[model samples]
Target: MENYFIESNAYNPWYNLAVEKYLADYVQKEEVILYLWQNQNTVVIGQNQNALRECRVQLLEAEGGYLARRSTGGGAVYQDLGNLCFTFVASEERYDVEEQLKIVMKACQKYGICSHFSGRNDLLTDDNRKFSGSAFSMTSRGKVQHGTLMINVDVNKLQRYLTPTQEKLKAKGIASVSSRVCNLQELNTGLTVDGMRAALRAAFEEQYGRCTELSLDMLNNDKIQEYYKMYSSWDWRYGRSPECETVYSHRFTWGEVEVNLKLHNLIISECKVYSDTLEVQFPNMLEGLLLNQRYDIQNIQIPEFHKADEELAKQLKETIMWFSGVWR
Candidate 1:
């Protein structure tokens, strides 16, 4: 087939995401795959993002939502049944984001809604309220460009699952970028997901000739199941991010201190400290001191200051104290 579509029957994020990776792993040169799927109560984080810093894993898990980490390098996003997901998988040389986005914009046009591709990876209305955000990943096999389509998505659950930290935005050098989203259904009450799916298929065919609709059963197999296990594993979802994204950074008269923590069950499973102090080894020293400690202000064990570095140590303590109070 020249163009094809695959709609998942699974709702589990792990399974859906596993299929996503599977498609990326085996992109055919002759055909481009348009995958439409959904995940229920899930928060997907970027590959380089710190998981703990990006998502409230404990709270989300407690509430029966999943935390998934994609292979792409981008910020976190929420997914549910009310949301529709789409991916365009093609060869590296044939891949094009602008052309792929046309399928989305064209689909919206059918609903009598004018949408614009705004910012880095979002499609917004004329007034600038976004209804979709997208992310990308390139594999050895091919390239995958995927995004969310908000029809009647639950925004309340999104707020609870995602606990974005300023450190992440600040570190990624995109602190000023801001976005607001509105469901497509909010703009047109008569619109349904089925209608959108039909529109998307027509647009996709218009852009890529004809497409074959592959049965979900044909796509389910041992290879996808293996990837599913990797996605569902604790290590994959809750593991360290961007060299530990849970960062506490501040500046003092001595220098700047940025502490990164990887917390497991409220304890510091891993720790790394970065400082621009004159003492090159000071940050390394703080890492060891903070490692294995509980993530609490009272539990922070301040080290004894060497006579020559006493002034720097005082400022370090002040920085820690400040982050401890505000990092809630």
Candidate 2:
């Protein structure tokens, strides 16, 4: 198969992620694509993770770091100009995780950095310090495997923004995040982001055929812009998180209402309504009504409370929608 190499000039995390999704989902050509991109200070969370639980929101916001959600399943990651992100997009028939990892390993070897795949999806040096981590997603037409290579990352910023799970920390037997990760530039003072990119490009050309370089303008079309809108929106980035319970309380002119919801697979599995002004039967009416229903207020069916309580019902609906992660 032919090889297409795309180096994204856009540093916006949303734009780079949009380009990755567009290539995986919309590109119909049967060829292997090696996409290299970088983002400014940003924290990218996995599709299945809870952003609030995985990141230090206050620190991220104060440091001017953006948060994004990728279409892959993995833990959260922090990125900056010092980090390099690579994505391998190919058809399902040609999807090979080991082969793709080998390509990255070969590139690292070119810079005199010896690393190997460790555990599930990490590339670690001989001393067991991790420098790269990867995640994967399958599209209808193909598959995408993307990873981050730590070149000259700001370790302090990485630790400040990302709050990894306790289980992950215990598994690595590391007490702190800074102790677990190392930068390529730290290992080899001569290695730069540009030099690493060159090494990876050469490795791709050696493994695949000649490379066809694609420009940022080529990807800035209307279709990609549409995808960028989706990726950049708050709803797609945070609202599409995995099913979890969330409590929301709102006080209106009428009264206060607290909504407790248990969502399973993005569907409302259980819901409880508490309000001071709502009728006695209002909570019961909402019990099975929204069961197995996705958290969309527009599509939700609201039963008629007493005509006098219309305002209360409206407030309750709005609060429930807000708890469902729908932002107006």
Candidate 3:
């Protein structure tokens, strides 16, 4: 039988350290799972992505937050006390990614909530709202699955922290700030963060077998420490991206304007905005927008321009609508 432990404490370095150890040291025959709680605000990005395009660095730093990169492939996610995190550690030979996902889906069903797998790797409700996001990674010996379940998170703050996907901003016909999302507590008032954690624990243990709770101090083996050091390094966190150029621009009545986004993989190389008009705020405004996205322009959505004259504004709005489907 496999051993599984569920934890209730909020964000700590030890939580991920345990996961790395399970993947590396735990023999293939034994399976280990962890449910981690994080109270501090943080952004966890995917392994195979550019960090600059994933998080709003200024907002995160102003709040004195931690930005972590995970061993998964997806976008960055905002996690806080209201979120419940889960990790499954198993030998690569025994890991069945699809079967593991079904275990999560079953847990949500037990709460009287119906969830369906959406897109490449997300669990959503019938109304097309996503509550849980997951990603996976593989080492030479084993595989690791980690993700988050939203309980009572702050949607306003979440939207404010992550860069908006261009397609979503354009197709919704509303400001990115106005996008809709929900929390588990909102749907089931009787359900708390701890309650959700218990449900997952029960469901996962049923199939993978069960084990007693093991404390971090007990599992501080040498191999585990090595994986933790790797996870916490700068090269593994923000130093894993390749070269790329991003574009950000604001368009108005006078034709259109464009900006060149420069980045050295994961860091901001520089920024340059060009326009034929005499607008003086182009550089500053572009810089402000740049603070939100690290080094990409393809996904950043420039806010609608402001006009002084009512008649001119109306005409510009109509013209903007025409290009909405085009540019967006």
The TM-scores, one per candidate, come to 0.73, 0.71, 0.67
lDDT of 2 by residue, 1-328 (tens): 6678989887899999989988998645567889999999998887767665566654675668788988887777889999999999998777788988888999999878899888768999989999999989888888999999999999888877775333211111112223388899888999999998999998888887698987767786887889889888767765665556765566766677666777654466788877785456556655656666765544767677788878657765765555444221
User: Which portions of model 2 miss their true places by more than 4 Å?
Assistant: 164-179, 243-328
A best-first ranking of the candidates according to their TM-score comes to 1, 2, 3
Better of 2 and 3 by TM-score: 2
The best candidate by lDDT is: 1
lDDT of 1 at 128: 92
Q: 262, model 2: CA deviation in Å?
A: 8.0
Top candidate (TM-score): 1
Compared to the true structure, candidate 1 yields what TM-score? 0.73
Q: What are the per-model C-alpha RMSD values against the true structure?
A: 8.1, 7.1, 10.2
Q: Write the per-residue lDDT of candidate 3 for residues 65-141, one digit (tens) a residue.
A: 76676666766778877887877676766677777778778788788888787765677777878788777777666
Model 1 lDDT per residue over 107-130, tens place: 999988898887677899988998
Candidate 1 residue runs with Cα over 4 Å from true position: 164-177, 244-328
On the 0 to 100 scale, the lDDT of residue 264 in model 3 is 62
